[model samples]
Target chain A: MTKKKLIYIILFLAPFAFIFLSLFVGRYPLSVPEVARILWGKLIFSAWGLQDISTTIVWDIRLPRAILGALVGGSLAVSGAAFQGLFRNPLVSSGILGVSSGAGFGAALAILLFNTTSYIYIFAFCFGGMAVLFSFLIGKIYNTTPTIMLVLGGVIVSSVFSALISFAKYVADPYNQLPAITFWLMGSLASARYQDIMVAGVPMLLGIAGLIAVRWRINILSMGDREAHTLGLNTALSKGIVVICATLATAGAVCVSGIIGWVGLVIPHIGRMLVGNDNKILIPTSLALGACFLILVDNLGRVISGSEIPLGILTALVGGPFFVYLLKKTKGGGW
Target chain B: MPLVEVSNAGFGYNGRAIFKNINLEVREGEVFCIVGPNGCGKTTFLDCLLGLLKLDQGDILLGGRNIKTIRPPDVAKVLAYVPQSHQKTFPYTVMEIVLMGRASYTGIFSSPSPADISIAEEALAIVGLQEYRNRPYTQLSGGEGQLVMIARALAQKTPVIIMDEPTAHLDFKHELTVLETMVQLVRNTGKSVIMATHFPNHAFYFENNDVPTSVALMDKLTFSVIGRPGEVLSEKNLKSLYRINARVVSYQLDHNTEVKQIIPISTLYSKESERVN
Candidate 1:
């Protein structure tokens, strides 16, 4: 590997090391050896008799939350990379097609009207399906593949969902559900559980794998629709499949842990800048870097304030200015 | 049998007719050049042949069958196209880009086979871009990029190769190089090549080659003359198509010299009467 590749691998691997250390070395400190023993013992026999309190804190609380954070972060980044390639625009993210807002609306509706069991997962899938359907419909109606139409469709659908969410908020009792809705919108992995992991992890993992497998096709599509078709690709069908797959992954992540922004938009750009624009390299690199980025951010959220900060706030705080700097540097040339 | 046939074909977009009542046939092992003014439906016609655009009126027969009835993959198996210019957003290498031409042959999940790789390499060598195989396609110069596009078409290994303005942005040397490559491709492989260009001099040069020949010169709006080079590329025809009073310049062959005559229509004159009182 080149020096740059080596450095990126080190940079990406660093955060996992820090997170592993931080998991045990907190306010209730456990030695690194004890942490290792706990992990190994749990893997083999399911009970490490060192301390019940440490087990609960490490396995029950922090571990699932951290894993959820990594899953969501990686899904968003991979989705963004696929979207950027599909639309041939560097600035696009998973949210460019109204996916997040649509999922938020579906979750809000489920919370308000259905109030049924496991409504979060249901709402997420429904919203994602609807967003993809609308995006395709709008693209078809326009008869053009210009990115502007997709963005406009996203904005319009997002506005509709935002209005619905606002209405739901107004009618919501200010005591319980209102707080839940607000917190969910703000985005957190604080309430993450083992069940959440199973629901979100499977689809996110599948999505990331699918994107990697189709990475070369995505690069061909980035050349434009005509070139792709002439290259013996069924451009429309392939694009639709990719969009649906990406939305499924994003929705799965958002179902468990609300709308965590910026990781999707920022990490892929960083991946491209560091590794160059080949999707074969960029996809895997984005996954690793995204996982690390979110873990570090989540750890910072935990450490800096003595109480956990919402992941959305932390991501925006870090991603916003960095995005501006990248914009300035690229000067919109690659788009 | 003719390799490609357009039987009274008509095509239009959004109800605006671009071309109507057009008919042409390209035989095997011929360099058929279509030349016309801007917006004269040259690219649109090529699109129809490639099945990218549906014809409004008639049928295009490829290999003596209606193109619409043939599966797209099957059409791709026999015909390949090189676009005028391609925009590069991702950094794919020249090898990767050329390998994409083999997509019709390769399975969906399988990588390009050894055969595919060798074909791509052969294409690169033919286009004189073998040394640039590993270079990022976006970093190539315009002429080099055009050559790579040709390489990609060649990699398809199809019997019929269609090109749209393959030398549009090329300099003088590259222009001659592309035309020369096309001539050699037809001569060596007996592949039918159809290309649309603004320059008719290229057609004149190709027709002068010592091979069984078929050539056509098409002008804007409705004029076509198809025959041997000396008959079709007369000064009257050249002046009419280009709308310039051109003097035909010929160079006699010295001993052991094989270069043919070249006509340079350098200046164009306005329409005026040459009246006798």
Candidate 2:
């Protein structure tokens, strides 16, 4: 049919194909029939005609990893698109509100204090949400969340939390907790168990749903607060809703996946190039692209070397240069 | 009743009074022009009427209802605003930009429907920019961008449109196009326009079109004069407000037509010999 419909179909289908491919693409390569048998057996009933190791490889490890990758990638990218539109700045991402740094510190601190497994997720999520709240409250110092002030608030909170994270590292046990914190900060989906997925899924889905619901309003909001107000938009309510949704999505993602960077920042730009800047299409497009991009990147992490490459390192190492290329190709335009 | 009525309305910020004790009215099929120096509260006055800001001393009413009582969405259905400048950050297509005008009617979560799309297309047709519908808005010139913005306001389907410095930063042709579009829209749709502008000639332009034009000059932070463009826009008023001696000249264009324009002669900062005679 139309070009846009074609793009949507491609975007919507790419993730499923990539995820299925990922099921058989690890240290233990399973054949197509084996992977299918494992999936069918595990999903339908008992693991009939499937080996235990094969089923665990397909259902337990790769499935959760791919699904978690999809959720976090979609959430972060969508949050970036929403924040970019709301702030009317192309360079801004959800992390501009200090969510990533805050979550990093929280995870680090949780590791420093408690040996409990779930404490990392809890601390990361709360601190991520709290960091954004602190940024938002700082933005409201002048009784308004003016764009500049909000960005400044994010910068302040980010630096402060960054310093705190550094301090936590210094006092941390170098032999035990230091490596844990460092590995977490470098970011990986090696630990994408069902527990992490279950913990992050609700808020991630909630934020994505909210952003989609308010997607059209982001167009009006990109006109700036005064213009939006004149257009009869309840900007205060709309802006608050956007901030909360973005915060939720961001914090939820950072909690499970640690600090996966650049996907949120770069994926929206790719979506914009494909769909133009209409948030209506750009948002969903970013979602699909982000899901696909992260799955692909995670695949590289699994297969590129003998050991798994950290997602945070891979994303920045690759995406940073690619972002610069996009910036140049766009010639400082299309923002 | 007037579409918008501002009586005894005053607004200020940070312990400074911007404007006070203002009374104004806008009727259907009328062009109400507010001209003043920069930051003379022309935009502030417009914001008050649009219910974006509350009147510090009094109230503004829309079609006999107090403006404060009407919610923003309802007020949007009544009046649309065209700001002085639009950011080019997003490369929104002209059609997408125009479709955003339907946002007032669309639910917060919903997309624009087919009916809204047709309405937006109709707005584009009215502005004669239908061919530019799919072009990136950021790629358009300042004048074309302003037309697209005007088309957006038209798409809102409001009874009145509020514009702040709509003709600013436009070439000669685009300025005339904007003024002509305003006159044509008022004539065709019976929609009133409340425009704040720096150019006194815009009032004369409307008057020349036989549109009922009322020019209000905000001098000394108040309405110094309000009446027909030719009668009220004098050299004395221009000097008092802009601190410049300006000539309000009438040029004979044809056998039966005269064009009125304002030409700045000298500023107070000019050398004595070069000062206005």
Candidate 3:
């Protein structure tokens, strides 16, 4: 095999390795062999001779958290890559259209009104989708100009939702609901469960599959609308599909993991540096690298202190410095 | 019939007329040049021909069919565009950029096959950029970038190519290289070229080719004359169109051959200098 193919193979395997390794690093640590035996027994014999605590740690806590981390990481990075290509700007992220802020507002509102976790997830997902849709509609009002206007609309919607989130914070019960809302916005996968994984995994996977299928066409889209139109692409339809897929993935991720930042913005740039700018390869590369990166960050967050650090803090702390390093190294032209 | 025929085509935006009574024909295997000052609607006319913009008054026909009837992909199949050199936001390799020209041939969900790769390679060879295939497009010089775009159009395998200011940002050597490449495409591959340029001399340069060549001198959003470059690009027309004092001179070579050249002397209006005097 070629060297590049070998590199891709190694990159693809890294995520699985991280997932397996992270399954043993949680607050209730399980040995590697014990975890592996439990996984193998669960998959095959449906029963493991391992202790109840071991099974609980592996099956209930670590597995869901790791899997959810991988799913959210992969989806966010892929969606971020898609948006960057769609906008023809490397600085863009999956949250460019106010999805994160909107989801934050929705979660805050749920905390203030319903005080229910499931309601928070549902409201967050719906509001995230609505935020993107609002931006798209505002952009449509000036159909003659698309990309710039859409960006502007996103800015407008994001600020509005941010204000709403602040308002919700003010009205929230300071001692009871306020901290909960604040913690959720700070972002963590600490409470990830199998149900949360199943609930959010489906849409994230669908969005990922859709992006992978249309990834090659995104190269043409990055050429700008006029060039894409001249190349015979239905610019509006292609762009709309990309935006929808990205929104669905981002919404699903935000609903489960809260507003985990930096994975979407920085992982794709790393992927582009490893594999060139061909979206066909870049999308998958971003998926694998993103999964591995977020899992590593999550593991670090749990193990670094007595209290588990929020994922948003660790990701930005790690990813932000790495991004600066990449800028210095590649001079911001990794593509 | 001409390969592209724009008959009485007019285009306006926001109820303001930009151009009207525009008529032109690009025959097969011809180098058709449109020369006018900036903002004379030359690019708009090309857009109308590409079916990107609908004409306000009349219609454009390609292969005797209404242009609006032909879908964008089908139009792309017939005509390729080489736009001016601009900074690329992403640093795609030359091969990747060239392969994107085959997008019209491939399905939206499908990747380029081996055959498409070969075609792209062949196009790179045509533009003499095969050696630079692995290089990042952003690292290429202005001239090389323009050549890569030409290679992309060549990869499209269209009979007609539309280039908007292909040599605008190039140095003198690059401009000559682009002009020579245009001549070669017309002479060897029998591809028709429709280029919008501000340089009347460029139109005249291609006029030296043996294949058919035509020039359209545009002014006030309409073609003042459209004919053989030698016939249409006269001193009087150049002066009128650009509001400059210039001469279309013929220079004799050592081998008893002659070449047409446009030399501008001065601008018609020097109000600032006049006021100073």
lDDT (Cα, tens digit) per residue for candidate 2, span A1-335: 49878888998898888888889788997899988877777788773655678888888899999999999999999999999999999889879999999999999999999946599999999999999999989999998778788889999999999999999999999999999999998888888999888889989999999999999999999989887887779998999999999899989988998899899888999888777899998999988988888887888899989999999888877777876887788764454
Worst-scoring 10-residue span by lDDT in model 2 chain A: A326-335
lDDT of 1 at B38: 74
CA lDDT, every model vs. true structure: 0.77, 0.89, 0.88
lDDT of 1 by residue, B1-277 (tens): 7889988788777888877777888887887777666777788888888888899998899889998898766788778899987877766689988987887786554457799999999999998999998787878888888888889889888899999998888899988888788888899999888888777666667766654444455565333776765567677776677655554455546654344443544435433323210
- Tens-place lDDT per residue, model 1, A125-200, is 6886697678767866768555557667777777877898899889987887787777777777777789888877
User: Candidate 3 clashing pairs?
Assistant: none
Model 3, span A1-335: residue lDDT tens: 49998998898899898888888896786776887878988888775455588887888888889899999999999999999999889989999999999999999999998988999999999999999989888888966647888888899999999999999999889999999999999899988999998899888998999999999999999998888888878788889889888998899999999999888888989888778899999999999988888898999999999998988889999998888898788766634
Model 3: CAPRI class:
medium
Better of 1 and 3 by DockQ: 3
Give DockQ: model 2: 0.75
lDDT tens string, model 2, B1-277? 9998888888899869999888889999998999899988898888888887777898788999998788888899999988899877788999999998887899888999999999999999999999999888988999999999999999999999999999899999999898889999999999999999988889989887788989999966688788888888898888888898888998888877888888887787778416466
TM-score of 1: 0.87
Once fitted onto the true fold, the runs of candidate 1 whose alpha carbons sit more than 4 angstroms away are A1-22, A25-27, A47-51, A111-117, A142-152, A166-179, A320-335, B113-115, B209-214, B217-223, B238-244, B253-277
- In model 2, the Cα lDDT at residue B67 comes to 81
Off by over 4 Å in 3: A47-51, A327-335, B254-256, B270-277
